[model samples]
Target chain A: MLRYTEDHEWLRAEGEEVVVGITAHAAEQLGDVVFIELPEVGREVTKGEEIVVIESVKAASEITAPLAGTITAVNDAVEADPGSVNSDAAAAWFFRIKPTEPDLTGFMDEAAYQAMIG
Target chain B: MADTPGGLRRTPLHDLHLARGARMVPFAGWEMPVQYPMGVLGEHNHTRAKAGLFDVSHMGQIVLRPAVEWPSGHARPAAHEEVNDLKLRLETLVAADVLGIPQGRQRYGLFTTPEGGVLDDLMIADKGDHLLLVVNAANVEADLAHLRTLEGTDVVLLDARSLMALQGPEAEAVLERLVPGVAAMRFMDVAEFDWDGARLWVSRSGYTGEDGFEISIPDHRAVEFAEALLGDEAVALIGLGARDSLRLEAGMPLYGNDMDAGTTPGSAGLGWSIPKVRRTGGARAGGFPGAERILAELAEGAKATRRGLRPEGRAPIREGVPLYEAETGGEPIGTVRSGGFGPTVGGPIATATLPAHLPEGATVWAELRGKRIPATIVPLPFIKPSYKR
Candidate 1:
C-alpha cells in the first residue's frame, strides 16, 4: 500500500522496506531541483525528523521522515541528477527505510492526500 | 498562496501577467510576478541570450519642474538659469552632480541623509525643461516627501505613467522596430517619441548590464505598447525573479539589500556616483547633505566596503549569510547582502560587505547551512556590461 504525508512525501511498502520520495505536487512546487543531500544509509531517524535537503535555484527545503525507521538504502541517482525528481517524482525515490513498527498511523491514503493538496 | 496578505496592490499589467500564467508574489507591497512558466533560471538565461520585457511600473516615476512657469503657451527655450537653479536645489538632497549632466543625458544618483547614509538610489534624466527621476518602488512615498520638504521646486509624481524595461543584447534591435531612432541613441541618452498616438519617454539605460532601454508610457496605453514589444520573436516577458538575478550577475547592488539608510555611498562601493564636483577638491564641494563625512570617506576610506563574492561550490548561498576568514575560524568579518545562483556564470555568486582593503582574489568563507563554503573576493560586475557607449 502507498501512503502520503502532509509534508508531501510518499511512502510505498515494498516487501520488507518502504520506499520514500516527494510527491509530484511537491516537486512541481520546488521547480527545477539543482541539488539534494540525503541521509546516509544505516542512519536511524524518528517520525517527522528531517532526512533530506533539496535545493532549487531559488530556495531550499527539507524532507522529513513520515515514520520511525532505519535508512537501508539511498538513491544516488537523484543526488547526481536532481532534476529526475522534477521529471518523475513518483519513481525517483530518495531513500528506503526498514520500518520499526510498520504502523502508518498518521499517514494518509491517495484520496486523502489528493484532497489535502487540493 | 494566491491571496497576498495586506491586500497587495497590482500594476497595470497585472491581468496580462495572470493571463500568461505568472506566479505572483507580494513584493514591496505590490503583487508582482516573481517568475512565469519559464521559471527563474530559464527566464534569467533567456534575458541574457535574448530580449526580455519587464513590467517595472511598480517603480516610482517623478517629474521635477521649476516653480515658475513660462507665461506664454508657446514652447519656451531651454531655460538655463531656471534649470540651473532647480539643479542646485536638488543638489542639496542628493550626492550626484546633477548640474553637470547635459540635457538629454541621464545619470545615476543617490539620495543621501545628513549623516552620509543612503536614503535611496535613483536615475535622473535631464529632460531640458524638467528633470525626471526614476526611483525604487518601496521608496516612492518617502522620496516624494523628502522632495516636497525642499523649497523652490515643483514635484509632480507621474503616478499615471507606467515603466517597462526591454533588456538584452537584442533589445536595441527589437525596440527600434517600434520606435525609430532608438538605435541612434547612445547609452544614457533620453528621448521622447510618439508611437501610435501615444508618447513614450525612453532612456537608453537599464538595470541589466545589457544594452537596453527603459520606456515610460501612459498607464492606459502600457498594455498596448507591451504587447507590441512582446510580438517580436526575440522578446520574452520576464519577471522580477530574473530581473534580480540578472542585476546580481551584473554586480549591481539593490537599494534595500545592498545599501539602506544605514549605509553610506562610499561604504556601499558607490562613491563614483558622487561626482568630483561634489567632492573635497571640486569647485562646488561640501554643498550636498553629508558632504563632510562623505568627502572624508572618499579621501580616506570606509571601514567596510561592498565586494563581489564567488562561492567555490554550487550551493546557493542566500542573503544574510555571515562571512569569516577561511583559514582562521573566528568572529565573522562580514555578511552577504545578496547571494544566488548565476545561471550565466554557471555558479553561485554574491555581494558581501567586507572589511575595507580586502584585496581581490582573497579567500573567505560563507557559513551556509552549518557548512563553511569557501568564497573568493572578486571585482564587481561578475559579467561585463554590454552597454552601447
Candidate 2:
C-alpha cells in the first residue's frame, strides 16, 4: 500500500518495512538532483518532521518525513547516483523503514498517487 | 509548462535548447535552458578546461541607431572611453562622462537611479555605425524605453538581435579559424568579419572571465553557427546553469542577483565603470539620475559591498541564508546573493553583501538547516581567471 503526503513524499509498506522517496512530480519540479541526504539507519522519524535534504543546481529542498518510523535501510544505490530520482522517482526509493505502527490504512494507492501528481 | 509569462518573449535558440536535453526553466519570464545532462558543475568545469558554447540568445541584443546619419552619432564610443571633448557626447544616460571607449570595445556599465542606486547593469559595445547593447533579459523592456528617449538626440536604439557566446580557453582558436582577422583583435576589442557568408561582429570579451568571444550572428544562422562550434571537439554545449556557476566562479555578478534597483555600481564593486575622467573632473558632466549620491559614493566609499563567501563544508548555502558573525554570534549581517557547489573549486561558494566595516577574512555563519554553517569572506573569482589577456 502506498500513501502520499502533501509535500510529495510517498510511503509504500511491504510487510513491516516501508519504502520512502519523492514522487515523479516532485522530481520534475526539482529539475536535477545533485546530492541527497539520506536518513541514517536506526534514526527515529516523526511524521511531518524534516527528513532529507535534496540539492539541485538551482535550489535545495528538504523532504519531510511522511510517517512515524525507524529507518531500517537506506538505498545506497540512489545515493551513489541521485539522478535515479529524476529518471525513476517511484522505483528510486530513498530508504526503507520499520514503522513504529505497522498498521497503515487510508493511504494513497497508485491511482491516488497519479491523481495527486496530475 | 505554461507558454507565456504574462506575454514575455523567448529566443531563436529555444528549440535547440530543448533538443540538446536541457532542463528548461523559467527565467525573467522566458523559458530558458538552465542546464543539460552534464550538469552545472560539469558544464562549468568543461568550459574552464576547454570551450563552452552558451546560447545566451534570451538576453536582449539591441542595436542603437544614431539620431544623425552622416557622422552617425560619432560611433557611440566604447564604455572605456575617456572624458574628453570629442568623446564627451558618448554617454547621455550615465552621469559619468564617457566618450572615451574606442570603436569596437565594450565595457560593463550601469543605469543608476537618482539616489545612486543601480537600475540595471548593461554591456555597451560601440559598433561604429550604431551601438550594440546587451541588457539583461529581465530588463529588456525597461532598458529599451530608457534608450528610446535618447533616440531623438544623437542615439537611435535598435531592437533585439541574435547573440551567442562561444566561451572558454579554446574559444579563440575555434573562432579564429572561422573569422581569420578576429585573432588579431586584442582582448576587449571587437572586429568585423565574415563567417560562412554571414557578416558577424565578434568581440574578444566574455563574462566567464575566460578568453572568449561573443559572436553577434544573424538570427537565421544562429543554429548553424551553434552547430559549427559544437562540432569542435574542444567545445561543448552549455546552458544557463553552467553560465551561472561559471560567472560565480569568475566573480561576475548576475544583474538580478548581484545587482538590482537597490544597489549602486560603486556598492557592487564596479568602480572601473566610473571613468577616472568623471572622478577627476575632465568634465563636470553630472545630469543623469543620482549624480550627487553616486559622485559622493565615488568620493567616499560604499556602505555595503558584495564579496565572495566560501563555506567550510561541501553543502551548498543558498540565497536568503543569513550571515552571522562567528566571533560575536551577533545579529545577522549580510545575505547570500548567489551560491552553488563550484566543481573546480571542490567546495561550495557564494556571493554576499556585508557591512563594509567587516574585515576581510572575517568568519561568518550561513544558516543552513537551522545550523550555522561557518563561512569566510574572501576575494572573488574563487578560481584563477583564464582570460588570455
DockQ scores of all models, one per candidate: 0.57, 0.38
TM-score of chain B in each prediction: 0.96, 0.89
Candidate 1 lDDT over B289-309, as tens digits, reads: 788898899889888999999
Instruction: Note the residue pairs that clash in candidate 2.
Output: B34-B241, B63-B158, B64-B157, B65-B156, B78-B101, B81-B100, B81-B101, B82-B100, B87-B99, B114-B290
lDDT of 1 at B40: 81
Candidate achieving the largest TM-score? 1
The residue-by-residue lDDT of candidate 2 on B1-389, one tens digit each, is 22465564567777777788888777888777878877676788889889999877777776655444336545444332222332344365664434656677877677777677777877777666556677787888887777666634343333334788888878889887777877787787877788889888788888887889888877778778888888889988888887887888889988878877788777777766777666645464456677677777877888888988989856788778888887445788888988987777767899998888877798888988778888988998888887656
lDDT, residue B347, model 2 = 70
TM-scores across all candidates?
0.95, 0.85
Interface RMSD of 1: 1.6
Could you give the CAPRI-style class of model 1? medium
Query: Model 2 chain B: which ten-residue window has the lowest total lDDT?
Result: B78-87
Candidate 2 residue lDDT tens string, A18-39: 8889888888777667678787
Chain B TM-score (model 1 vs. true structure): 0.96
> Which stretches in model 1 have alpha-carbon errors above 4 Å?
B1-6, B70-78
